[model samples]
Target: MNILNTIRERRSIHTFKDQEVNTELLEEIFTYGSYAPTHYMTEPWKIKIYQEGGKTAFVDAILASYQRIGMLKMDGSPKSVKMNDSMKKFLLEIPHHAVIYFEKKEDLIRYEEEYASVCAFIQNVQLAGWEHGVGMLWTITPYMHDPQFLKDIGLNNEKVKIAAVMQLGYPDRVPKDKGRSPIQDKLEIITD
Candidate 1:
Protein backbone atom coordinates (compact mmCIF):
# COMPACT_ATOMS: atom_id res chain seq x y z
CA MET A 1 0.00 0.00 0.00
CA ASN A 2 1.09 3.57 -0.62
CA ILE A 3 2.43 5.42 2.43
CA LEU A 4 -0.13 8.20 2.14
CA ASN A 5 -2.98 5.72 1.79
CA THR A 6 -1.80 3.77 4.81
CA ILE A 7 -1.58 6.96 6.87
CA ARG A 8 -5.09 7.95 5.86
CA GLU A 9 -6.60 4.53 6.51
CA ARG A 10 -4.90 3.72 9.81
CA ARG A 11 -7.13 4.04 12.86
CA SER A 12 -6.67 3.51 16.55
CA ILE A 13 -8.20 0.08 17.12
CA HIS A 14 -9.06 -1.05 20.64
CA THR A 15 -10.63 -4.35 19.61
CA PHE A 16 -8.79 -7.16 17.82
CA LYS A 17 -9.21 -10.75 16.65
CA ASP A 18 -7.58 -13.81 18.25
CA GLN A 19 -5.34 -14.53 15.28
CA GLU A 20 -1.59 -14.16 15.84
CA VAL A 21 0.44 -11.65 13.82
CA ASN A 22 3.08 -13.12 11.52
CA THR A 23 6.55 -13.13 13.15
CA GLU A 24 8.29 -11.85 10.00
CA LEU A 25 5.81 -9.01 9.67
CA LEU A 26 6.34 -8.01 13.30
CA GLU A 27 10.10 -7.95 12.75
CA GLU A 28 9.69 -5.81 9.66
CA ILE A 29 7.62 -3.33 11.64
CA PHE A 30 10.33 -3.12 14.28
CA THR A 31 12.95 -2.62 11.62
CA TYR A 32 11.01 0.40 10.39
CA GLY A 33 10.79 1.66 13.97
CA SER A 34 14.54 1.34 14.44
CA TYR A 35 15.17 3.54 11.44
CA ALA A 36 13.59 6.67 12.92
CA PRO A 37 15.91 9.68 13.08
CA THR A 38 17.79 10.60 16.25
CA HIS A 39 20.28 13.26 17.27
CA TYR A 40 23.98 12.37 17.42
CA MET A 41 23.12 8.96 16.00
CA THR A 42 22.15 7.82 19.51
CA GLU A 43 19.56 5.16 18.78
CA PRO A 44 17.90 5.09 22.19
CA TRP A 45 14.67 3.26 21.45
CA LYS A 46 14.09 -0.27 22.76
CA ILE A 47 11.07 -2.52 22.28
CA LYS A 48 9.93 -5.64 24.09
CA ILE A 49 7.58 -7.77 22.00
CA TYR A 50 5.06 -9.89 23.90
CA GLN A 51 2.80 -12.37 22.08
CA GLU A 52 0.90 -15.64 22.62
CA GLY A 53 1.57 -16.87 26.19
CA GLY A 54 3.75 -13.85 26.75
CA LYS A 55 0.77 -11.59 26.10
CA THR A 56 -1.14 -13.13 29.03
CA ALA A 57 1.82 -12.72 31.35
CA PHE A 58 2.30 -9.12 30.24
CA VAL A 59 -1.35 -8.26 30.80
CA ASP A 60 -1.39 -9.92 34.22
CA ALA A 61 1.72 -8.04 35.26
CA ILE A 62 0.19 -4.75 34.11
CA LEU A 63 -3.01 -5.38 36.10
CA ALA A 64 -1.03 -6.50 39.13
CA SER A 65 1.10 -3.39 38.96
CA TYR A 66 -1.96 -1.17 38.72
CA GLN A 67 -3.51 -2.92 41.69
CA ARG A 68 -0.31 -2.61 43.63
CA ILE A 69 -0.41 1.13 43.02
CA GLY A 70 -4.09 1.50 44.02
CA MET A 71 -5.16 2.52 40.53
CA LEU A 72 -7.82 -0.19 40.31
CA LYS A 73 -10.66 0.45 42.71
CA MET A 74 -12.83 -2.29 44.16
CA ASP A 75 -16.08 -3.00 42.35
CA GLY A 76 -18.72 -0.22 42.68
CA SER A 77 -16.27 2.25 44.15
CA PRO A 78 -16.88 5.99 43.63
CA LYS A 79 -13.41 6.83 42.31
CA SER A 80 -13.76 5.54 38.79
CA VAL A 81 -10.65 3.79 37.59
CA LYS A 82 -8.99 4.98 34.38
CA MET A 83 -8.32 1.39 33.33
CA ASN A 84 -11.37 -0.69 33.93
CA ASP A 85 -11.90 -4.45 33.78
CA SER A 86 -13.07 -4.21 30.18
CA MET A 87 -9.86 -2.55 29.10
CA LYS A 88 -7.83 -5.12 30.95
CA LYS A 89 -9.88 -7.89 29.39
CA PHE A 90 -9.28 -6.42 25.96
CA LEU A 91 -5.55 -6.19 26.64
CA LEU A 92 -5.38 -9.79 27.77
CA GLU A 93 -7.03 -10.96 24.58
CA ILE A 94 -4.78 -9.05 22.18
CA PRO A 95 -2.36 -11.11 20.07
CA HIS A 96 0.65 -8.88 20.84
CA HIS A 97 1.91 -6.12 23.14
CA ALA A 98 5.00 -4.01 22.53
CA VAL A 99 6.61 -1.98 25.29
CA ILE A 100 8.63 0.91 23.86
CA TYR A 101 11.38 2.52 25.89
CA PHE A 102 13.88 5.31 25.28
CA GLU A 103 17.25 5.50 26.96
CA LYS A 104 17.82 8.99 28.30
CA LYS A 105 20.79 10.94 27.06
CA GLU A 106 22.95 12.95 29.47
CA ASP A 107 22.24 16.26 27.79
CA LEU A 108 18.76 17.72 28.17
CA ILE A 109 18.53 18.51 24.47
CA ARG A 110 19.58 14.97 23.68
CA TYR A 111 16.84 13.65 25.96
CA GLU A 112 14.21 15.59 24.03
CA GLU A 113 15.70 14.41 20.77
CA GLU A 114 15.50 10.79 21.90
CA TYR A 115 11.83 11.21 22.84
CA ALA A 116 11.01 12.76 19.46
CA SER A 117 12.82 9.90 17.77
CA VAL A 118 10.76 7.37 19.70
CA CYS A 119 7.55 9.11 18.70
CA ALA A 120 8.59 8.96 15.05
CA PHE A 121 9.45 5.30 15.53
CA ILE A 122 5.97 4.57 16.86
CA GLN A 123 4.38 6.41 13.93
CA ASN A 124 6.42 4.30 11.58
CA VAL A 125 5.25 1.11 13.27
CA GLN A 126 1.61 2.21 13.12
CA LEU A 127 1.82 3.00 9.42
CA ALA A 128 3.64 -0.25 8.71
CA GLY A 129 0.93 -2.20 10.53
CA TRP A 130 -1.75 -0.42 8.54
CA GLU A 131 -0.18 -1.59 5.31
CA HIS A 132 -0.38 -5.19 6.55
CA GLY A 133 -4.07 -4.95 7.51
CA VAL A 134 -3.10 -4.97 11.18
CA GLY A 135 -4.15 -2.51 13.87
CA MET A 136 -1.96 -0.92 16.52
CA LEU A 137 -2.99 0.99 19.62
CA TRP A 138 -0.50 3.08 21.56
CA THR A 139 -1.16 3.21 25.31
CA ILE A 140 0.65 4.59 28.33
CA THR A 141 -1.14 3.39 31.41
CA PRO A 142 0.07 4.64 34.80
CA TYR A 143 1.18 1.12 35.66
CA MET A 144 3.63 1.28 32.78
CA HIS A 145 5.48 4.10 34.53
CA ASP A 146 5.70 2.32 37.88
CA PRO A 147 9.29 2.17 39.06
CA GLN A 148 9.21 -1.48 40.05
CA PHE A 149 7.63 -2.52 36.81
CA LEU A 150 10.21 -0.50 34.87
CA LYS A 151 12.95 -2.31 36.76
CA ASP A 152 11.35 -5.66 36.04
CA ILE A 153 11.35 -4.76 32.35
CA GLY A 154 15.11 -4.12 32.56
CA LEU A 155 14.69 -0.39 31.98
CA ASN A 156 17.17 1.73 33.87
CA ASN A 157 15.50 4.57 35.75
CA GLU A 158 18.70 6.54 35.58
CA LYS A 159 19.00 6.21 31.82
CA VAL A 160 15.75 5.03 30.28
CA LYS A 161 12.04 5.89 30.45
CA ILE A 162 8.91 4.14 29.24
CA ALA A 163 7.60 5.90 26.13
CA ALA A 164 4.57 3.80 25.26
CA VAL A 165 2.90 0.37 25.26
CA MET A 166 1.66 -0.58 21.80
CA GLN A 167 -1.01 -3.28 21.32
CA LEU A 168 -0.84 -5.11 18.00
CA GLY A 169 -3.24 -7.49 16.22
CA TYR A 170 -5.70 -7.89 13.38
CA PRO A 171 -8.75 -5.72 13.95
CA ASP A 172 -12.08 -7.45 14.42
CA ARG A 173 -13.72 -4.55 12.60
CA VAL A 174 -12.38 -1.97 10.18
CA PRO A 175 -13.46 1.55 11.13
CA LYS A 176 -14.53 4.22 8.67
CA ASP A 177 -11.99 6.94 7.91
CA LYS A 178 -12.13 9.96 10.17
CA GLY A 179 -11.66 13.37 8.60
CA ARG A 180 -8.71 15.57 9.44
CA SER A 181 -8.29 19.34 9.70
CA PRO A 182 -7.24 21.27 6.60
CA ILE A 183 -3.46 21.64 6.28
CA GLN A 184 -3.84 25.28 5.19
CA ASP A 185 -5.31 26.15 8.59
CA LYS A 186 -2.17 24.96 10.37
CA LEU A 187 0.52 25.71 7.83
CA GLU A 188 2.40 29.02 7.56
CA ILE A 189 4.82 30.52 5.06
CA ILE A 190 7.59 32.82 6.23
CA THR A 191 9.01 35.65 4.16
CA ASP A 192 12.06 37.77 4.88
Candidate 2:
Protein backbone atom coordinates (compact mmCIF):
# COMPACT_ATOMS: atom_id res chain seq x y z
CA MET A 1 0.00 0.00 0.00
CA ASN A 2 1.08 3.54 -0.75
CA ILE A 3 2.17 5.75 2.16
CA LEU A 4 -0.62 8.30 1.64
CA ASN A 5 -3.33 5.64 1.56
CA THR A 6 -1.87 3.91 4.60
CA ILE A 7 -1.88 7.19 6.49
CA ARG A 8 -5.49 7.89 5.55
CA GLU A 9 -6.87 4.39 6.16
CA ARG A 10 -5.07 3.23 9.30
CA ARG A 11 -7.26 3.46 12.39
CA SER A 12 -6.54 2.85 16.08
CA ILE A 13 -7.73 -0.67 16.75
CA HIS A 14 -9.48 -1.34 20.07
CA THR A 15 -10.64 -4.89 19.60
CA PHE A 16 -8.22 -7.64 18.56
CA LYS A 17 -8.85 -11.13 17.27
CA ASP A 18 -7.67 -14.06 19.42
CA GLN A 19 -4.50 -14.77 17.53
CA GLU A 20 -0.75 -14.48 18.09
CA VAL A 21 1.32 -12.26 15.84
CA ASN A 22 4.63 -13.81 14.84
CA THR A 23 7.72 -12.39 16.58
CA GLU A 24 9.68 -12.03 13.34
CA LEU A 25 6.90 -9.97 11.79
CA LEU A 26 6.80 -7.72 14.85
CA GLU A 27 10.58 -7.25 14.67
CA GLU A 28 10.36 -6.37 10.98
CA ILE A 29 7.72 -3.76 11.70
CA PHE A 30 9.89 -2.30 14.48
CA THR A 31 12.87 -2.26 12.15
CA TYR A 32 10.85 0.07 9.98
CA GLY A 33 10.05 2.09 13.08
CA SER A 34 13.75 2.47 13.77
CA TYR A 35 14.05 4.49 10.57
CA ALA A 36 12.31 7.46 12.26
CA PRO A 37 14.39 10.61 12.29
CA THR A 38 16.37 11.40 15.41
CA HIS A 39 18.48 14.27 16.62
CA TYR A 40 22.22 13.46 16.86
CA MET A 41 21.38 9.95 15.66
CA THR A 42 20.19 9.00 19.13
CA GLU A 43 17.46 6.43 18.54
CA PRO A 44 15.98 7.00 21.96
CA TRP A 45 13.34 4.29 22.18
CA LYS A 46 12.95 0.97 23.96
CA ILE A 47 10.05 -1.48 24.05
CA LYS A 48 8.99 -4.24 26.45
CA ILE A 49 6.47 -6.55 24.85
CA TYR A 50 3.90 -8.55 26.85
CA GLN A 51 1.62 -11.23 25.47
CA GLU A 52 -0.21 -14.42 26.50
CA GLY A 53 0.65 -15.37 30.09
CA GLY A 54 2.97 -12.38 30.38
CA LYS A 55 0.05 -9.98 30.23
CA THR A 56 -1.33 -11.04 33.60
CA ALA A 57 1.37 -9.35 35.66
CA PHE A 58 1.29 -6.20 33.60
CA VAL A 59 -2.52 -5.98 33.89
CA ASP A 60 -2.35 -6.56 37.62
CA ALA A 61 0.17 -3.78 38.03
CA ILE A 62 -2.09 -1.46 36.05
CA LEU A 63 -5.09 -2.36 38.23
CA ALA A 64 -3.01 -1.71 41.32
CA SER A 65 -1.95 1.64 39.98
CA TYR A 66 -5.54 2.58 39.14
CA GLN A 67 -6.67 1.70 42.65
CA ARG A 68 -3.69 3.52 44.19
CA ILE A 69 -4.56 6.65 42.27
CA GLY A 70 -8.23 6.32 43.23
CA MET A 71 -9.28 5.79 39.62
CA LEU A 72 -10.60 2.40 40.65
CA LYS A 73 -12.42 1.51 43.85
CA MET A 74 -10.96 -1.21 46.02
CA ASP A 75 -13.84 -1.49 48.46
CA GLY A 76 -14.56 -4.95 47.07
CA SER A 77 -18.18 -4.13 46.41
CA PRO A 78 -19.91 -6.16 43.73
CA LYS A 79 -19.92 -3.23 41.31
CA SER A 80 -16.20 -2.45 41.75
CA VAL A 81 -15.31 -6.12 41.58
CA LYS A 82 -17.32 -6.44 38.36
CA MET A 83 -15.65 -3.41 36.87
CA ASN A 84 -12.16 -4.66 37.67
CA ASP A 85 -12.97 -8.10 36.33
CA SER A 86 -14.27 -6.69 33.09
CA MET A 87 -11.23 -4.49 32.68
CA LYS A 88 -8.89 -7.41 33.32
CA LYS A 89 -10.71 -9.55 30.82
CA PHE A 90 -10.63 -6.89 28.16
CA LEU A 91 -6.93 -6.19 28.58
CA LEU A 92 -5.99 -9.86 28.61
CA GLU A 93 -7.77 -10.49 25.33
CA ILE A 94 -5.43 -8.21 23.40
CA PRO A 95 -2.72 -10.38 21.83
CA HIS A 96 0.18 -8.07 22.63
CA HIS A 97 1.20 -4.94 24.52
CA ALA A 98 4.38 -2.96 24.00
CA VAL A 99 5.55 -0.65 26.75
CA ILE A 100 7.62 1.95 24.94
CA TYR A 101 9.99 4.15 26.87
CA PHE A 102 13.21 6.11 26.69
CA GLU A 103 15.89 7.07 29.18
CA LYS A 104 15.50 10.52 30.69
CA LYS A 105 17.90 13.28 29.80
CA GLU A 106 18.76 16.02 32.31
CA ASP A 107 18.97 18.80 29.76
CA LEU A 108 15.52 20.20 28.99
CA ILE A 109 16.04 20.75 25.28
CA ARG A 110 17.70 17.36 24.84
CA TYR A 111 14.84 15.72 26.74
CA GLU A 112 12.24 17.26 24.45
CA GLU A 113 14.23 16.24 21.40
CA GLU A 114 14.41 12.64 22.61
CA TYR A 115 10.69 12.57 23.38
CA ALA A 116 9.85 13.92 19.95
CA SER A 117 12.07 11.30 18.31
CA VAL A 118 10.34 8.51 20.25
CA CYS A 119 6.93 9.82 19.19
CA ALA A 120 8.00 9.63 15.56
CA PHE A 121 9.28 6.09 16.11
CA ILE A 122 5.89 5.07 17.53
CA GLN A 123 4.03 6.50 14.54
CA ASN A 124 6.33 4.59 12.22
CA VAL A 125 5.59 1.36 14.11
CA GLN A 126 1.86 1.97 13.83
CA LEU A 127 1.98 2.74 10.12
CA ALA A 128 4.23 -0.20 9.32
CA GLY A 129 2.11 -2.59 11.38
CA TRP A 130 -1.07 -1.43 9.62
CA GLU A 131 0.37 -2.35 6.26
CA HIS A 132 0.91 -5.90 7.48
CA GLY A 133 -2.70 -6.46 8.64
CA VAL A 134 -1.79 -5.64 12.24
CA GLY A 135 -3.30 -2.80 14.22
CA MET A 136 -2.14 -0.89 17.28
CA LEU A 137 -3.73 1.37 19.85
CA TRP A 138 -1.32 3.85 21.33
CA THR A 139 -2.56 4.46 24.85
CA ILE A 140 -1.50 7.10 27.37
CA THR A 141 -3.41 6.10 30.45
CA PRO A 142 -3.07 7.63 33.91
CA TYR A 143 -1.43 4.49 35.28
CA MET A 144 1.55 5.20 33.06
CA HIS A 145 2.34 8.19 35.26
CA ASP A 146 2.37 6.25 38.49
CA PRO A 147 5.87 5.60 39.85
CA GLN A 148 4.94 2.38 41.56
CA PHE A 149 3.42 1.07 38.38
CA LEU A 150 6.64 1.76 36.56
CA LYS A 151 8.60 -0.16 39.18
CA ASP A 152 6.19 -3.07 38.97
CA ILE A 153 6.74 -3.14 35.24
CA GLY A 154 10.54 -3.09 35.82
CA LEU A 155 11.17 0.46 34.64
CA ASN A 156 12.90 3.01 36.84
CA ASN A 157 10.58 5.98 36.74
CA GLU A 158 13.31 8.41 37.76
CA LYS A 159 15.58 7.27 34.94
CA VAL A 160 13.10 6.58 32.17
CA LYS A 161 9.89 8.02 30.74
CA ILE A 162 7.11 5.92 29.31
CA ALA A 163 6.23 7.17 25.87
CA ALA A 164 3.20 4.92 25.44
CA VAL A 165 1.67 1.52 25.99
CA MET A 166 0.80 0.18 22.58
CA GLN A 167 -1.86 -2.54 22.44
CA LEU A 168 -1.38 -4.61 19.30
CA GLY A 169 -2.79 -7.58 17.37
CA TYR A 170 -4.77 -8.65 14.36
CA PRO A 171 -7.75 -6.32 14.55
CA ASP A 172 -11.11 -7.79 15.34
CA ARG A 173 -12.76 -4.79 13.73
CA VAL A 174 -11.59 -1.60 12.07
CA PRO A 175 -13.34 1.65 12.93
CA LYS A 176 -14.75 3.90 10.22
CA ASP A 177 -12.69 6.88 9.18
CA LYS A 178 -13.54 10.18 10.79
CA GLY A 179 -12.41 12.81 8.34
CA ARG A 180 -10.01 15.53 9.38
CA SER A 181 -10.35 19.28 8.89
CA PRO A 182 -8.59 21.03 6.05
CA ILE A 183 -4.91 21.65 6.73
CA GLN A 184 -5.21 25.13 5.23
CA ASP A 185 -6.95 26.27 8.41
CA LYS A 186 -4.01 25.21 10.61
CA LEU A 187 -1.23 26.01 8.16
CA GLU A 188 0.23 29.52 8.07
CA ILE A 189 2.33 31.35 5.50
CA ILE A 190 5.08 33.46 7.04
CA THR A 191 6.90 35.59 4.51
CA ASP A 192 8.83 38.49 5.87
Candidate 3:
Protein backbone atom coordinates (compact mmCIF):
# COMPACT_ATOMS: atom_id res chain seq x y z
CA MET A 1 0.00 0.00 0.00
CA ASN A 2 1.15 3.52 -0.72
CA ILE A 3 2.35 5.51 2.31
CA LEU A 4 0.08 8.46 1.56
CA ASN A 5 -2.95 6.21 1.23
CA THR A 6 -2.15 4.56 4.55
CA ILE A 7 -1.87 7.94 6.21
CA ARG A 8 -5.15 9.03 4.74
CA GLU A 9 -7.06 5.92 5.80
CA ARG A 10 -5.56 5.10 9.17
CA ARG A 11 -7.84 5.76 12.10
CA SER A 12 -7.56 5.54 15.89
CA ILE A 13 -8.90 2.16 16.95
CA HIS A 14 -10.62 2.15 20.31
CA THR A 15 -12.18 -1.30 20.19
CA PHE A 16 -10.56 -4.55 19.13
CA LYS A 17 -11.38 -8.21 18.65
CA ASP A 18 -10.35 -11.07 20.96
CA GLN A 19 -7.51 -12.16 18.66
CA GLU A 20 -3.90 -11.52 19.60
CA VAL A 21 -1.55 -9.49 17.44
CA ASN A 22 1.23 -11.41 15.70
CA THR A 23 4.51 -11.24 17.63
CA GLU A 24 6.66 -11.15 14.53
CA LEU A 25 4.61 -8.29 13.13
CA LEU A 26 5.11 -6.30 16.32
CA GLU A 27 8.86 -6.87 16.12
CA GLU A 28 8.87 -5.56 12.59
CA ILE A 29 6.98 -2.46 13.63
CA PHE A 30 9.46 -1.77 16.40
CA THR A 31 12.37 -2.35 14.07
CA TYR A 32 10.98 0.29 11.72
CA GLY A 33 10.42 2.63 14.66
CA SER A 34 14.06 2.30 15.71
CA TYR A 35 15.07 3.82 12.41
CA ALA A 36 13.41 7.17 13.23
CA PRO A 37 15.93 9.99 13.14
CA THR A 38 17.28 11.78 16.21
CA HIS A 39 19.18 15.05 16.41
CA TYR A 40 22.13 13.30 18.07
CA MET A 41 23.31 9.74 18.50
CA THR A 42 21.55 9.52 21.87
CA GLU A 43 18.58 7.18 21.64
CA PRO A 44 16.25 8.46 24.32
CA TRP A 45 13.17 6.34 23.74
CA LYS A 46 12.21 3.32 25.88
CA ILE A 47 9.26 0.98 25.46
CA LYS A 48 7.75 -1.65 27.74
CA ILE A 49 5.35 -3.93 25.89
CA TYR A 50 2.61 -5.82 27.72
CA GLN A 51 0.46 -8.56 26.23
CA GLU A 52 -1.42 -11.72 27.26
CA GLY A 53 -0.69 -12.48 30.92
CA GLY A 54 1.69 -9.52 31.12
CA LYS A 55 -1.13 -6.98 31.01
CA THR A 56 -2.13 -7.53 34.63
CA ALA A 57 0.51 -5.25 36.11
CA PHE A 58 -0.40 -2.33 33.86
CA VAL A 59 -4.15 -2.71 34.43
CA ASP A 60 -3.87 -3.20 38.20
CA ALA A 61 -1.66 -0.17 38.57
CA ILE A 62 -4.06 2.01 36.61
CA LEU A 63 -7.08 0.78 38.56
CA ALA A 64 -5.27 1.26 41.82
CA SER A 65 -4.35 4.81 40.94
CA TYR A 66 -7.91 5.59 39.88
CA GLN A 67 -9.20 4.25 43.17
CA ARG A 68 -6.49 6.06 45.10
CA ILE A 69 -7.43 9.44 43.65
CA GLY A 70 -11.16 8.78 44.05
CA MET A 71 -11.68 8.76 40.32
CA LEU A 72 -13.87 5.74 40.87
CA LYS A 73 -16.49 6.69 43.39
CA MET A 74 -17.80 3.72 45.28
CA ASP A 75 -20.91 5.29 46.71
CA GLY A 76 -22.61 1.94 47.29
CA SER A 77 -24.03 1.98 43.79
CA PRO A 78 -23.89 -1.52 42.38
CA LYS A 79 -23.36 -0.24 38.85
CA SER A 80 -20.61 2.22 39.75
CA VAL A 81 -17.90 -0.39 39.46
CA LYS A 82 -19.51 -1.40 36.21
CA MET A 83 -19.21 2.14 34.88
CA ASN A 84 -15.70 2.71 36.19
CA ASP A 85 -14.50 -0.65 34.99
CA SER A 86 -15.25 0.15 31.36
CA MET A 87 -11.74 1.46 30.75
CA LYS A 88 -10.28 -1.64 32.32
CA LYS A 89 -12.46 -3.94 30.29
CA PHE A 90 -11.58 -2.15 27.08
CA LEU A 91 -7.91 -2.38 27.92
CA LEU A 92 -8.22 -6.13 28.38
CA GLU A 93 -9.88 -6.42 24.99
CA ILE A 94 -6.82 -5.12 23.19
CA PRO A 95 -4.03 -7.52 22.26
CA HIS A 96 -1.08 -5.32 23.23
CA HIS A 97 -0.11 -2.30 25.26
CA ALA A 98 3.10 -0.37 24.69
CA VAL A 99 4.42 2.07 27.27
CA ILE A 100 6.57 4.76 25.70
CA TYR A 101 8.99 6.97 27.63
CA PHE A 102 11.85 9.38 27.19
CA GLU A 103 14.94 9.40 29.41
CA LYS A 104 15.79 12.71 31.00
CA LYS A 105 18.93 14.70 30.32
CA GLU A 106 20.58 17.67 32.06
CA ASP A 107 20.70 19.76 28.94
CA LEU A 108 17.38 21.41 28.13
CA ILE A 109 17.88 21.45 24.37
CA ARG A 110 18.99 17.84 24.32
CA TYR A 111 15.99 16.83 26.41
CA GLU A 112 13.61 18.50 23.97
CA GLU A 113 15.38 16.93 21.03
CA GLU A 114 15.16 13.50 22.62
CA TYR A 115 11.45 13.90 23.25
CA ALA A 116 10.88 14.99 19.67
CA SER A 117 12.76 11.92 18.46
CA VAL A 118 10.59 9.66 20.59
CA CYS A 119 7.45 11.29 19.23
CA ALA A 120 8.65 10.63 15.71
CA PHE A 121 9.38 7.05 16.64
CA ILE A 122 5.78 6.62 17.86
CA GLN A 123 4.42 7.97 14.59
CA ASN A 124 6.53 5.44 12.69
CA VAL A 125 5.17 2.57 14.74
CA GLN A 126 1.58 3.68 14.19
CA LEU A 127 2.06 4.02 10.45
CA ALA A 128 3.77 0.67 10.18
CA GLY A 129 1.01 -1.04 12.16
CA TRP A 130 -1.66 0.53 9.97
CA GLU A 131 0.07 -0.87 6.92
CA HIS A 132 -0.45 -4.34 8.37
CA GLY A 133 -4.18 -3.76 9.06
CA VAL A 134 -3.48 -3.22 12.75
CA GLY A 135 -4.32 -0.03 14.61
CA MET A 136 -3.00 1.81 17.65
CA LEU A 137 -4.37 4.44 19.99
CA TRP A 138 -1.92 6.55 21.96
CA THR A 139 -2.94 7.77 25.40
CA ILE A 140 -1.38 9.27 28.52
CA THR A 141 -3.53 8.46 31.49
CA PRO A 142 -3.09 10.28 34.78
CA TYR A 143 -1.79 7.08 36.36
CA MET A 144 1.27 7.12 34.12
CA HIS A 145 2.68 10.01 36.14
CA ASP A 146 1.92 8.49 39.51
CA PRO A 147 5.12 7.28 41.16
CA GLN A 148 3.47 4.25 42.74
CA PHE A 149 1.90 3.31 39.40
CA LEU A 150 5.22 3.70 37.59
CA LYS A 151 6.94 1.54 40.19
CA ASP A 152 4.30 -1.14 39.78
CA ILE A 153 5.06 -1.14 36.06
CA GLY A 154 8.76 -1.74 36.98
CA LEU A 155 9.84 1.79 36.19
CA ASN A 156 11.32 3.34 39.33
CA ASN A 157 13.34 6.03 37.67
CA GLU A 158 13.00 9.67 38.66
CA LYS A 159 14.78 10.54 35.44
CA VAL A 160 12.26 9.04 33.03
CA LYS A 161 8.89 10.46 31.97
CA ILE A 162 6.05 8.47 30.52
CA ALA A 163 5.19 9.78 27.09
CA ALA A 164 2.26 7.60 26.13
CA VAL A 165 0.51 4.24 26.44
CA MET A 166 -0.25 2.85 23.00
CA GLN A 167 -2.97 0.23 22.66
CA LEU A 168 -2.52 -2.02 19.62
CA GLY A 169 -4.67 -4.65 17.94
CA TYR A 170 -6.78 -5.44 14.89
CA PRO A 171 -9.69 -3.04 14.85
CA ASP A 172 -13.15 -4.39 15.49
CA ARG A 173 -14.40 -1.49 13.41
CA VAL A 174 -12.64 1.20 11.44
CA PRO A 175 -13.69 4.78 12.14
CA LYS A 176 -14.50 6.98 9.18
CA ASP A 177 -12.16 9.73 8.18
CA LYS A 178 -12.47 12.91 10.23
CA GLY A 179 -11.28 15.83 8.18
CA ARG A 180 -8.69 18.22 9.50
CA SER A 181 -8.26 21.96 8.99
CA PRO A 182 -6.98 23.14 5.63
CA ILE A 183 -3.20 23.18 5.30
CA GLN A 184 -3.29 26.72 4.01
CA ASP A 185 -4.68 27.89 7.36
CA LYS A 186 -1.66 26.53 9.26
CA LEU A 187 1.06 26.97 6.68
CA GLU A 188 3.05 30.07 5.88
CA ILE A 189 5.54 30.91 3.16
CA ILE A 190 8.25 33.41 3.91
CA THR A 191 11.27 34.23 1.79
CA ASP A 192 13.07 37.52 2.35
List, in order, the clash count of every candidate structure: 0, 0, 0
lDDT preference between candidates 1 and 2, better one: 2
RMSD of 2: 0.7
Instruction: Please give, for residues 26-62, the per-residue lDDT of candidate 3 as tens digits.
Output: 9999878888898876767889889999887778788
- Candidate ranking under TM-score, highest first, comes to 2, 3, 1
Which model is ahead, 1 or 3, in terms of lDDT?
3
Candidate 1 regions off by >4 Å? 74-88
On the 0 to 100 scale, the lDDT of residue 171 in model 1 is: 94
Q: Candidate 2: which stretches are off by over 4 Å?
A: none
Q: On residues 150-182, what C-alpha lDDT tens digit does candidate 2 reach at each position?
A: 999998999999999999999999999999999
lDDT of 1 at 68: 75
Model 2 / residue 30 / CA error / Å: 0.8
Tens digit of lDDT per residue, candidate 1, span 6-74? 878899988799898889999998888778887778777888988877766677677767777987755
The local distance difference test score of model 2 is 0.96
